[model samples]
Structures are given as structure tokens and as C-alpha cells.
Target: MILKKHLKSIMSVTLAVGLVLSMAVAQPNLGMAASADDETYSGKTPKYVFMFIGDGMSYPQVSSAEMYLGELSMPGQITPEQLDFTKFPVHGALMTQDSTSFIPDSASTATSLASGKKTLSGVINMDETKSIAYTPITEALKEKGYKIGIVTSVPITHATPAAYYAKVANRNDAYGIGKQLAASGFDYFGGGDFDQKTGPKGADQHIYEIVEGAGYTIANTNEEILALNNKSGKVVAIDPDDYEAALDYEIDRADGELALSDYVAKGIEVLDNSKGFFMMVEGGKIDWANHANDAAASIHDTIAFDESVEVALDFYRAHPKETLIIVTADHECGGMTIGYSLTGYSTHFDKLQPVKMSYQEFDKLVKEYQAAMPSDPMLSDLADEIEDAYGLDINNLSDYQSSMLEDAFEKAMSGEKPSDDQEKVLYGSYSPLSVTLSHIVNSSAGLSFTSYSHTGTPVPVYAMGAGSELFDGFYDNTKVYGKLSVITKLDK
Candidate 1:
């Protein structure tokens, strides 16, 4: 009996010793885990930060872009890299933009992301009481001795990009906003030219001159921009008006036409100081096309935006630890929703054709058809135009369908809703072709779009690099600004 007791005591001692040794080894790994929580920035200061905003992009937008590009591949669909902004190593969801109202405008949403605070609709970086509520991440970084740049496909003084550097009660205050942009002392500013002719009647006639006077070497062409040596603290602005005569998509092919990605790469090249730099690149036109209900055009622009992300991702591949890239949207426009199947339930979008014509092209065709016809042409005439543009044979469609389409077209021209049948055919009832195509794109490539207007839906945020850990779960849009500030340590 004594021997039995002795054996049990020996076993307990052995087990206790084993546990102590195991814990001792795990102590080092636990330190590594704790270090992950503490080590926000890598050893080197971030030499560069790129924030790409696809304005008005929600999950539906991303899905629509994917399905549009992939058609209806069943087994292995295309990946996000195939889209314009592609995919990120880390991603999270952002709250649906909400201001005083349920649906927030671009200005307020952008302001939230830029300043880490919610502001009123139509206001830039200002709160409901018309007070300048917050300082932007760019301003914070600039104060910390980092070069700053802001680029967008839309006008430079437009809502999203302007929120980063300008403070104003109204977004329409572009002329004044331009002056503030000039005075901000950012290293690079590129994109469409704002209609500075409208604000406050006889305001400053030389806002561009003001920008040039602020030690910025202003240029209109890509050649002049590329030729610039890093020594020149330059600000290059591309006037979209100068290229107005050219087709919108063709402008990028011009001698000086620069893609948004080109601006991003150039900004990085020029602002590669040892201290670091912060840049924002916006695919501004995706929202514009969606607002106009131009599915093809929106998909095309989404592809372009994805390409710009690829440029940043490539930069990260080379300097993974030193750069942080974040991609997100300000809000979603067009209330876009993806529908079920158009024909039968086959899980394939076979009826739709790849959209080749621009929204302008279809708009022009519809206008000419209306102008040339006598007073109130038959339903057949409108169907012919839609058939030619969409490559769908409406001849065999039900009389109800045909009538509905004609009525819808007439109402569209007159700026009114069409008859019931026409509304059903044009916008779809149980299954909308436009919305269905958007879903096919999403399901195929994990890209899908829902709705045609800015939805009260939340958008996704994708992040990568040293500070990406901050974008893990649901958070307010303002948190994005704070996260970037924390990761870059710009607040210091």
C-alpha cells in the first residue's frame, strides 16, 4: 500500500514538471503575439501611403464589376486582380454612410473618411452647425514633414478629394476650394479641372496662378510631368476641358492623358522622401456612370480603378513592410441591386451581350430617334433602337413588353415614369437584366452589384501592409482616418 501511494505521488510530480517546461517554451511565442499588438509600425517609417477611393462603391458595385468582366464562368471564376481595384490582403466592412439623413451624400461621406468625423451633407469637412469640425489625415501628415498628394478622375475640387484638403460650408464652393488647395502646400495635385467660373461672381480670376505661385510647377501633359526631376516641388493639374473634344475614354491615350494610376505612380516617385508621403487616388467616375444608369460604363470605369490598385500592389510587393495600401469607397450611388436570372433559372447570363457602347452613345441614339420621328411614334421604333444598342431581339417579345418599353422611352424623354407594361420591360419586374448581369459578375468572381443608386448599404474596406490590422471589424468611416494616423504615427 505504501509503494502504491509513492507511485501516484511520483506521477503527479512528473506531470507538474512537464507543464512548467511547456509553458516556459510558449512564453517566447506569447511575447511575439504581444509584440504584434504593440508593434503598430514596422522598423522603418512608412515611406509611402496610398489610399484609393472608388466613390459610391458598395458590395454591389464590386460584384457588378466582377460579373461584368467574367461574363458567366461557372467553375473557377476570375479573381479580384482581374477587376480595376482587385483584392487586398486584408478587408473589412464600413458602415453605410449616414448623416443627418439616412443616405449620406458624397461630401459628408468623404469628409468622414478624411477627418475622422461625421459632417453634414453637401458640406466639406464641416459639421452640421457649419463649423470646420476636423483636420484631415493629409494635413496631419504634412505637419509631420511628409509630402502629400491628391488625385481623382473627377474634378480636383470635387467632393471626395476636396474633403481631404479644403474646408467649406458647401461643396459647390469650388473656386474658394481651389484657392485653399493652392495654399495647402501639397506636393502633387492632379485630375479634372473644376468649373471655377461660377463661384461668388467675380472671385479670384487666377486660382491656377495661385497654385503655380505656391511653388508648384504646373503642367497639363504627362510628358512634362514625367520629365520633372524630384528636385522640383511641383503640382501638376490636368485640364479635362483641354481634352474635351476627345472621347472621354480616349483622353487617356492622348499625348498628355494620364490614367489615375499614372498619377499615383508619379506621386510616389516625386514624393519618395526619407520622411515619407501620403497620397489619395480616386476612381471618381464610377459613381458618375452608375448615377446615369450606365451599367457598361460603370463596369469599364471599375476595371480602370482596379488597374490603379494593381500599380500600388506592385509597389507593395517590392517594399511590403514600408508601404500601406488601402482601398474603399465613400458611398454607393444608383441604389444598385443584383437580381436573379433573366430568362430561366440556369445560373448563367447567356442573354446579355458585352456592353461596347458608351452611355453617351446610347443617349445620343435615343435623342436622335426622338427628334427625327413624327409626333408620337409607335412602340416598335423605340424597340429597334434598344435592340441595336443592347443587341437584344425585342421583335418576339410580348406586345405588353413591347408597349411597356416604348412608353418607358417616351416617359424617359419627357422625364416621367412610363406606363406599367413599359416600366416592367424597361426596368424589369421579377428579374432586371441590368441587375442580374451585376450579380452574375459578383457570384462568378466574388464581385456583385446591387441597386442603381447610392444604397443605404455598407461598403467594404480592403487593406494591406504594416498597419492593416486596424481595419479588422465593423467601424465608423471616421475610424479609417484615425487608423491611418495611428499606423503612420503622423499625429506625433
Candidate 2:
């Protein structure tokens, strides 16, 4: 009896020991560089940080991009290319609702991410009452001597990017945001041109002039920016052509266009300083494309953002122990979901392969054609343009699709404006060609969108590198700043 009892106790002890060994192997040794065994960073503090914001990028957005990439695989290619950021060690769902409403706007959501607090819609860093104001993470880091870099695929003064630097009552206060961008006096700013050039209500001088007046060297071309030798001074580079308010969508960009990752690499080159740095790169056009219900365009822009992720990953590899990289979205726009009712359990994702130009480009194409052609041009003329832009076979189009285009073309020929309902469904633009083509392809591909505006769904968060373990588990959007503070030891 005594021997049996002793054997039982021994077995229990052996099992317990095995469990401990397994747990130790499963856990990562935080505060140490990914590739080093150096003890210099033996504590929970990051020296370098990167925060990537995919505007309107929620779970559906990420999943869509993944599946689309899968469909693009070549025949007999066993392993498809996955999104680079999905391999992050820590993942979480962030509740993006603000203090005021369930469906939050960009300004309020960005305010929550920028500061560890909730604020009203359209208000920058201030609370709903307009009395309590919070300093942004960028401002906080800037005060600590960390170099700051901001890059976006939209206007540098857009809501998400502006939340980090500008504090204002209204997001439409573009001129004010532009002035703040100049006066922020951080280190680097790269993206599209500002929506407003000067003052609160359209002042006389251009915004670039103010930025240059503040001692920033503005670069307009790829060669000019890449060859920049002025490492000590602040730099600002925006595309010189003011065609669209933001950079071109990746799907429609011309040859030799600078990609989102190129901007990220350039910002890193310019902002890497001795005191450390905090840089933000935004995939702003993902939200814009989703707003237009353009799945192909959104996926291409998401790929662009992933390329920027790769750029940061190379930097993280070199300084893994001191660097922290986080990728998330401020809100979920378009209420996207897979498995559309038309396809049930099956979908033809390759149907999206035919889409070429973006909805905006298609709208512009029709307008230009109409302006140059005679008043009573035949339907084949417009049909040929649509076929060319969308890869649609007009002969194969359903009658309903044909009628949709015919009515809209007739309206355009008569110079009639789009109705309120038409505008809401088609991204506030008059384009039956774009609407019909997208509907035909997207339905077959099993992609669907619930609304044209932002949804209250929680966005996904992916993080890696030093201090990355702190980002796991679900949390409020405001807690982003808190987690960042704890992980980086910003308060200490």
C-alpha cells in the first residue's frame, strides 16, 4: 500500500513538471530583440514604435483582401501569398463606438485612438462638452524628443491623420488643419496635398507656402524625395498635381506611381533619429473605396498597406527588441460581409478580376466623353467605353443591367443630375455604368455591403515586435492609448 501511494505521488509530480516546461517554451521572452539575446532591453519598454491605421479596415476588410489574394493564385501554385500583417503574434478586436453614438465617425474614433479618451463626433481632441481637451500620442511623443512622421494615402489633413496633430471643433476646418500640420514642427509629413491652403476661411496664401515658410523642404517628385540629403531639417512632400483630393487608388494608379510602402520607406529614412521615433502610415483610400462599394479597389489598396507593413517588418527585424509595430483601423465602413444571398455557400471570386478602373475614374471617363462628343451620340459609343473600362461583355449583359445604363446615359445626355436615392446607392455620383458593372460582378463573387456609411462593428488589431504581448484580448478603442503607454513605458 505504501509503495502504490508513493508511485501515485511521483506520477503527479512528473506531470506537473512537464506542464511547466511546455508553458515556458510556448511563451515569448518579452523586452528582448527578436534576433538577439542581449540583456540591454530586459524590461517592458519599447524604444521605437510604428502605428498603422487602415481607415475603415475591419474584420471583413481583412478577410476580403485575404480571399481575393487567394483567388489570384496561379495554376498549380500550392501555397498562396498571405497578407504580411496576419502573421503578427498578438491580435484583438477593438470596440470603435465613441461616447456619443454607436456608429462613430472618423474624427471621434481617431480621437479615441490618439488619446486614451472618448470625444464627440467631428471634435478633434476635445471631449463632448468642449471643455476637456486631451493631448495626442504624437504630441506626447514629440515632447519626449521622439521624431514624428505622418503618411497617408489621403490628404495629410484628413480626419485620421489630422487627429494625431490637429485639434479642432470641426473636421471640415481644413484650412485650420493645414496650418496645424505646418506648426506641428515635428519631423516628416508625406502624402497628398492639403484640402485647404491657408487660414480658417480660405486665406490668401497656399498651405505649401506656409509649410515652406516654416522651414520645411517640400519635394514634389519621386527622384526629388529619394535623393533628399537634408537629413537634419523637416521635410514635406505632396504630389504636385491637384487632380483628386487624395492619392490615386492603387487599382487605378498610372505607371511609376509612388506606392504606400514607398512613402513608408521614405518616412523611415527621414525620421530615424537617435532619440527614437513614432511613425504613422494610413491606408486611407480603403475607406474611400469601401464608401463607393468598390471591392476590387479596396483590396488593391489593402495590398498597398501590406507592402508598407513589409517595409516596417525589415526595420523591426533589425531592432526587434526596441521596436513595436501595430496595425488596426479606427472604424469599419460599408458593413461588408462575405457569402452573399445570391451565391449561398459558393462564390466565383475570380469574377472580380475583370474590374480595371475605379468608379471615380469611370465617372470621369463618361463625363469627358460626353463633353467631347455630339449631343446625340449612339449608345454603342458609351457601351464601348464601359466595356473597355470594366471588361464587361455588353452582348452578355442582362436586360436589367442594360436598362440601368440606358436610363442613366439618357439622363447624362439630357444634363440631369442624379437623384438623392441614386447618389446614396452609388457613392454620391451619377454613374449607372459603374453601378451596374460592380453589381453584376460583386454579386457573382459573393461580396455584399449593407450600408454606404460607417458601421458599429469592432475592428481587428494586429501587433508584433517589442511589447507586443500587451495588445491581445478585446478592449475599448480608447484603451489603445493606455496599452501603448504601458507597452512603451511612455509614462515612466
Candidate 3:
């Protein structure tokens, strides 16, 4: 009873402190200490703003990536290598719950960030009733003569990016979202192409056709996009290779291919102007890789995301007093945790070095193997290929591990259904052989995932530059916009 009372007292004290911090931010002059002429909330608005969202990144994802890099550089040593954004001067936490559920989706959480409001999951830029639409900070900034750029590693019309410029009752309305993108009047839209060029039924006009008709230049090749400049009035730069889907995972990206950081750098080049610009860069593939429970892919993508933030950091150095950079996430996906049952209190992130490709790439390899071996292929027959792909020596596996592979291999090759509940747990929706491979490799690295969906976890917020001090406290995701509005006074 005494211990319970002490715990209650601690909770009470923490809540009271949080309330005090929130109240402090409510004051108009709580901006960072700066000169009278400095462009802070107390003075003029910041001229440049960059919002970097690592789609599924949270504390575990961030720490794991740092640890992986540290292990790669100093094998078996306890060095702590960190991402650039983590070293920002100010940090806070965001409660990601939307109006409806504790577990939030990208659309709703992103809406909360873009606009100071909460909506239902899968809804974008609209209230829960869907009758009233909320204007995102991007619109307000645009009205203030700031060019807006939206860049992502996923589809341009994906939920996270769309929340800034599009409003739809359902996120699946790809054609509608694409139309909104064409009409958004933003300066730049770079990354993946329209997920659905035509309507869902394939009867409507192509979105690209609409985009071209709306007077936007479309760059589909590397040379075409690289040649673009600030003079290239309005632009939509699509990934030359992955035109229909997301950009390649960092682990699978080929040399010279346009990565997320490339798009962000290009955005900086094109969006720079006298009045300034607001750019939203998303490392979206991190979420997809985590959803598939691929730790190596997730880590590489997280690193790639940090590289994009570094691009902004470089820009900030040139315009320190006039720039603001914020790094955050929509929500945490996959319930990712750093520790694993097999390696308690120890992590061998270097073991992940052998994972040369992502689970998606490995699935293609499985398909090729299946096609090459028409007759009944056995698990033992692909031992050499397994070793080559994931560096997992199949010959050295214990009987129990071999049995698991045999079951997954048979189901993958022969199109056999799981015999019971245990097999279902072994492989859910994903290719059985591929998921099993990821599970084994991830376990070897001392990482694990609890769910294949978004979790009810609060995401981190890292900020720096003008008015960054206002972000140094726990708050709801909606307060992200509220804080930005305070800095720029745009909502007024």
C-alpha cells in the first residue's frame, strides 16, 4: 500500500510538471531569446522551415539505427554513433492518439501535425464529421508568399504527404488525391508517381494527363529532373525507376538512383526564394519495411532519412537565424523493440551486415527459385542460395530450425495452406519463406517486432533554429501545428 501511494504521488507530480510546461508555451513571448530584429516569434517569422517525418520512427527505431552504425564502425565495441537530428538542441514527445483510437494511422496523425486538429484514422485534413475541412499550415504559409514543397519516399499521394494538401474522406481515394495534388498550386511535388494514374475502375482520365493539363512540368528521368532549376515554374519529379510504387529501400538502392535525400536537396535548390519556403520531407519506406518486420531494411531507411535531415541542417547553417528545422514521426509502427528473447541484454547489430537485401527483394528471389525448380523443391536443395542471400548457413541449422524452414518452404513452393494456428503465426500474409528469413535474421541481430501495424506509442520531436525552444515539452501531435502557428503567426 505504501509503494502504491508513492507511485501515485510520482504520477501526480509528472502530470503537474507537464501542465506547467504547456502553460508556459501558451504565453506569446515564450519564443527563444534573440535580438529585437531577430526573426523569431517575438519578431518576424522564420523565413525557412523544414519538417522531416520518419514515418514509423520512434525511440527504438532511432536507437537501433544508431547502434547498428556504431557496431558497423567499431565491431564488438561499445561506441555510440548517433544520427544528426538526435543531437538537436530541443527535444519533446508527441502523443499520437487521434480522436477515435489510441493506435493511430499515418493519415490521422499527420493531419494532427499539419493542422492543429484531430480526425479519425484514414481521414485527411477534415474533422471527424467530415463536413468541416481544416486548413494545414502549408496553405497558410503559401498565402504568406512561402513556396511549399512536399517530398516523400512513398507515393506522392500517400497519407503522410497528402495530409498537407489534400482532403478526402478515405485515404484509398487515390484518384481524388492525385487530382488534389495537381491542383494544390504548391511549388514542388517530388518522389513517387501517382499510385493510381486512372480511377479505380480504370475508366477515368489519367492523373498525369490532368497534371500536365494543369501546367506543371513532369520530370520522369534522372537527367530531366537534374536539369530542372528554380526557373522551372511548377514541377512534379517522379522516381524514374519506381514510378508506380515507393523508392527503393536504402539496402536495395542501386548506385546513382535518386534517394530520399536527393529529392530533399533538389527541393532546397528549387524552392529557395526571397520570401522563403516550407518543405515536408518524409522517409516513408521506414514504415513499410517495419510493417514487413525487416530490421536491416528499416535501419538503412532510417539512416537514409537522417541523411535527408542533414541536407536541411546544411541549409540551416547558411541561414541560422531565419531557418527552423523539426524532425518527428507520424506514429510508431510494428511495435519495434530493441531487445530480443534470444539475446537478452545484448545486441549483435553487426550480424545484420549480411542481410544484403530487404524482405521484398528476397521474395523475388524465392519466386525465381520456385520457377527454376518445377519439380518438388526441397528446403535442403536451396541451402546454397539461402547462404548467398542472407548469409544464413542452412547446413548448420538445428533440427528444430530446419523443420521450421521445411514447413515454410513447402508452403511457399507448393501453395499449401498452414496446417494449424502455429503455422499461421509463423507467416502472416507475407511470403512464408521471406518472412521466416527476416524473422531469423532480425532475431540474430537482437531486434523484434510485436505487431505488423502501428502501435499506441508516443513519437519523439527534435527541433532547432528559430523559435525551437517552444518545442521542448511533452504535447499532443496537434500542438505541433499550434507551436508552428505561434512561431509564424500564420493561423492568425
**TM-scores of the models, in the order given:** 0.77, 0.86, 0.91
lDDT of 2: 0.79
Q: Where does the lowest 10-residue lDDT sum fall in candidate 2?
A: 30-39
TM-score of the candidate numbered 1?
0.77
- Residues 1-492, candidate 1: write the lDDT tens digits: 999999999999999999998877532211011122323544445767889899877776687667655664543353332453445668788874545555788888898788777767898877667854557778878988888888888888888889889999999888988888888888887767754734578655676677777777776665676765567676765744333312154212345456767767777777778787888988888887666555556666777788788888888889898888889998877766555434332333233344445555555666676688657665456555556555545576555545544545455556443347645434433223332322333232232234445667788898887778677788667667767766776645
Q: Give per-residue CA lDDT, model 3, range 46-105, as digits (tens).
A: 899999999999988899899999998988887769899999999999989887788999
Which residue pairs of candidate 3 clash?
Answer: none
**Arrange candidates by lDDT, highest first: which order?**
3, 2, 1
* Segments in model 2 whose C-alpha atoms lie over 4 Å from true places: 1-42, 74-81, 229-232, 377-379, 411-423, 426-430
Q: Which candidate is the best by lDDT?
A: 3
Per-model C-alpha lDDT, please?
A: 0.67, 0.79, 0.87
In candidate 2, what are the lDDT values of residues 114-209, reduced to their tens digit?
Answer: 876777788887767777667888987888888999998899898899988988888888888888888999788888778877565665688878
TM-score top scorer: 3
After superposition on all C-alphas, the RMSD of every candidate to the true structure, in Å, is: 11.4, 10.1, 5.0
Model 2: number of clashes? 2
